[model samples]
Target: MPIDTTPNAAIQRSLRQCLSNAAFMLYQQGHVLETITIPFRGLDGSALRQLREASREWPACQQVLESSEAAVYNEHGRFVLTAMGRELLFDMFGQGAADCA
Candidate 1:
């Protein structure tokens, strides 16, 4: 039998919200300064898979992260943001706040 891959609406929203928040936080803390894949942990299998798969498409969420003010190339295997990413993070956070509604 095949695994049911479809994620529920709540899970999908949660995933996007989590990723946005995580990226913003990482930017604020200066952790993400390069292109890196955040270790797939903590999230459920579906969420993780969604992120992985989404990266394959154009203009991905990771791309948003990379395009931020503090983005950089991932020499190490860790999700990072460059200087621009940090600035962009502030913007993203601000925008995300509005999404809370």
Candidate 2:
């Protein structure tokens, strides 16, 4: 389905949910290499794409970049979670699992 462009409360909530989903997806995959722009597959892309589609709803999600090796993007493509991103992901998954249990 095409994402709604019109701004509303639902869009705001979906945007936040998408961010949380993306963060959790990345965190579950764990920090492997050091690259923000790694070639992601599976759920990772879905999570990110969902957020991307809702970019207009939340601009903050755009700031959340993947961490990489050498402290910057380089030819050695490998991606890891940033310190802040990891913390956010941890909190998101932790709370989610706790709530489910």
Candidate 3:
């Protein structure tokens, strides 16, 4: 068998999935993932940290959000999803059972 040379690709896919899931959860609750505080008590600390890190480094995800002005840091230094973010969440997770209300 050949060596797995696509570790970063796999990680990126997983990161996108995780971030999409987190965004959907927040959308359902009319909230957004914030850096200043943990959005969900049940969310794994490491996963949350990874999501935050991806928000800064992931070009596809971060660039889209930033270009659309969807992801923004509030005055208190917390990352909150804007209205456009909700729309982007819908695109990422699909118009599934997650209510983006």
Name the candidate that leads on lDDT.
3
Candidate 3 versus truth, CA RMSD in Å, comes to 10.0
lDDT-sorted candidate list, best first: 3, 1, 2
Candidate RMSDs in order: 13.5, 11.4, 10.0
TM-score for each model: 0.31, 0.29, 0.36
Off by over 4 Å in 2: 1-18, 23-63, 66-75, 95-101
Q: Estimate candidate 2's alpha-carbon lDDT, on a 0 to 1 scale.
A: 0.39
Q: lDDT value for candidate 1?
A: 0.42
Model 3: what TM-score?
0.36
In Å, residue 6's CA in model 2 sits off its true spot by 21
Q: Better model by TM-score, 1 or 3?
A: 3
Assess the local accuracy of residue 100 in candidate 3 as a C-alpha lDDT between 0 and 100: 55
Q: Kindly list the per-residue Cα lDDT of model 2 for residues 51-98, writing each as its tens digit.
A: 456545323444434211111222333233434444434455563322
Model 2, residue 15: C-alpha shift (Å)? 8.8
**Could you tell me the lDDT of residue 7 within candidate 2?**
58
lDDT of each: 0.42, 0.39, 0.49
